[model samples]
Target: MHIFYTPDITQGTYTLSEEESKHCVRVLRLGVGAVVNLVDGKGGFYTAEITSDNPKKVGLLITDVKLEFHKRNHHLHIAVAPTKNIDRIEWFLEKATELGIDEITPIITDRSERKVVKDDRLNKVITSAVKQSIKAYHPKLNEAISYHAFMNLAFEGDKLIAHCIDGDEKSYITDLVQPQQKYLILIGPEGDFTPDEVNLALNKGFKPLTLGDNRLRTETAALAVCFEINYLNR
Candidate 1:
């Protein structure tokens, strides 16, 4: 099934954008009456038949529509500093979306290597992951913000901070996470979080948790925590 994305779909006839039209009529060579699927990335999926094969504005006749409900009982939000290698960070977003994440925020920490991020590029990676994984729900992607600013966002769930700081008291994320509960995990940059930053998170009621024995890269740690939370929820 070839599933395309469109934000709006009305009754009778709908048109595909130039990029989608090209894919359907030119690349795929889908003719009139061909079966195609679409998603609005807002919990709506449709099964439609091609009405026109125009490569500039392919038309479709909506045959069936299915409204998908939010499936997960728990929410997993990860906020991490973008890595110096943008590809690695993008990889994390893809894998996390496949593994089922509700939210992602790019944070700017004191030791963060990259301050600016291309939201459009990252959003495309996320969309591809959702389609590839055959998932109806799309993950929420927040614009890049400073660490201190991100902390202020209202989160009605368990909050955690993962850092490489020295502390005798540290619990594994798997142990701290409970089933059917909302969660947010904060992963630091390559240089890890500054002492002041860790203290700030602690003051905000964020628990300090460790990923594992072996030290992991920024992306690895972020993905690990995302998967671990998903596993526990299941």
Candidate 2:
């Protein structure tokens, strides 16, 4: 199915962007009366038909709409430190979106190698993943912020911080996670969170999460958390 990201679509006829128009008419060669799909990235999935197959501005008429499409019972929010290699973090974003996640925040910690992230490029990765997976909901990508600043934000769910240090005191994610509950998990950078950072998160009611004995890379750890949470929910 040819799916276009139409975040602003409502109940009516809609026009594809110039880039999408060219891909639809010239590349895909979809002509008038051809059927296509649209996702608003806000729980809206729509079926549209080609009205005017102009290469510069393909017009579409909305034929059907489904709200809250494939809605999940649980909400997951992961605040992970970005990797030094930008591609690794981008890979995590793409896989996390494909696997199913509600929100993501790039966090900066004391041992963080890379602190800055291009929001637009990361968002595009997520957008492409959403379309490839045929998902109606779009995962939210928050701007990069300090670890302390992120901790200050209020979260009314199961807060968790994953780290390799202090393994004895930490609990495996499966031991703590319950089905159909909201979850907010924190993943550290390559160097992992400092001892003080873990202590601070503990003081703030965030439980320590341990993936396993094997030490995983920054992106791998984040994807591990994503898979575990989504699996438990499933």
Candidate 3:
């Protein structure tokens, strides 16, 4: 069945946006009475049938609704530094959404090569991932903020920081993670977090996290954390 992202959906008939309408009526050639699935990205999933196959404004009648569809037990929020190559960060967003992330914030660290991020473009990537993965909830992408500002924000969860600093004892995520709890993790830039930055996070009550012995890139590290958290929850 074809799945469409319809975040504003409510009860009764609904209209697809012009873009989705064209894709449905023209590209997919779906006609009236065609059955399709819709996800509101807020834990609402609907089964609908096309009522008007207009190529510019296709309409549908919602037949069934499911709320809180496939809800996860925990919330995973990753604050990662944007990679110099924008594609890498975008890739991380896509994979993380599929793997189950509740929130994402692009943090700018002292060694970060990329400081600015276009939220609009990155959001589209996350939305596309949500549909592709048949997810009922959309991941929230926060505006890019400096590492210091992110640290000051109040978060009630298992706080962790992943870095490459040596001589500091770091625990594997599997050991520290507790199922059914909120988690906030910080992943630094390519050069990794400066010693001072690490110390600051530690002072803020964030624990050291180690992915493994081998070093990973900024995006890779973020995805690793996403996968690890989802795996532990599963």
Candidate 4:
């Protein structure tokens, strides 16, 4: 089933945006009375039928809708420092959305090479991923914030930091988080979190965790913990 992102769709009748209209009518050649599906990016899945094949504004009639589709047992949020290579960070955003996560934040750290990020572009990548993966829930892309500022946000359940620094401060993620619990994992940049940053997080009650024996990049490590959390929940 072809799925479209229709955030503005109402209960009975719906009109596809110009972009979606063109893709449905001109490109995909879906005509009137055709069965199609939609996602509202709000944990809603809708099955709709094309009522008018206008190339600029295809109209639809809602046939069915399912809420909380593919709902996960846990809410996973990963806050990581954006890499200098923006492409790598973008890749992480895309894959993480497909794998299913609740939220993502770009942590600005002292060791960070790229502090500024374009949220619009990053969100677009996430939307594309959600549509491709046929997921109803859209991952929330939070604004970039300093590592110091990020720790101040109020969050519930597991709060973890994935760092490579040595000493008796880190546990493998598998041992750290219990299954099916809300979690937020912080990942640092290519240079890793500063000694002071690690201490601050630890002092704030953030559990120190390691991905595995091998050192992984910021994106890889964040994705690893996300995967593990969802894996363990199953």
TM values, all candidates: 0.95, 0.98, 0.98, 0.97
Candidate achieving higher lDDT, 2 or 3:
3
Task: Give the winner by lDDT.
Answer: 3
* Candidate 3 C-alpha lDDT tens digits along 1-234: 688999889989999999999999889999998999999999999999999999999999999999999999999999999999999999999999999999999999999999889999999999999999999999999999999998899999899999999989999998887999999999999999999999999999999999999999989999999999988989
Instruction: Encode model 2's per-residue lDDT on 1-234: one tens digit a residue.
Output: 999999988788999999899999989999999999999999999999999999999999999999999998999999999999999999999999999999999999999999789999999999999999999999999999999999999998899999888544888888997989999999999888999999999999999888988999989999999999999999
Error of 1 at 202 (Å): 0.9
When 3 and 4 are scored with TM-score, the better candidate is 3
Model 4, 113-200: lDDT tens per residue?
A: 9979999999889999999999999999999999998888788999999888889457777787788889999999999998899999
For candidate 3, what is the lDDT?
A: 0.94
Better of 1 and 3 by TM-score: 3
Error of 4 at 74 (Å): 0.5
Model 1: CA > 4 A from native: none
Poorest 10 consecutive residues of model 4 by lDDT?
168-177
> How do the residues 51-104 of candidate 1 rate in per-residue lDDT, one tens digit apiece?
999999999999988787447879898999999999999999999988999899
Model 2 steric clash pairs:
none
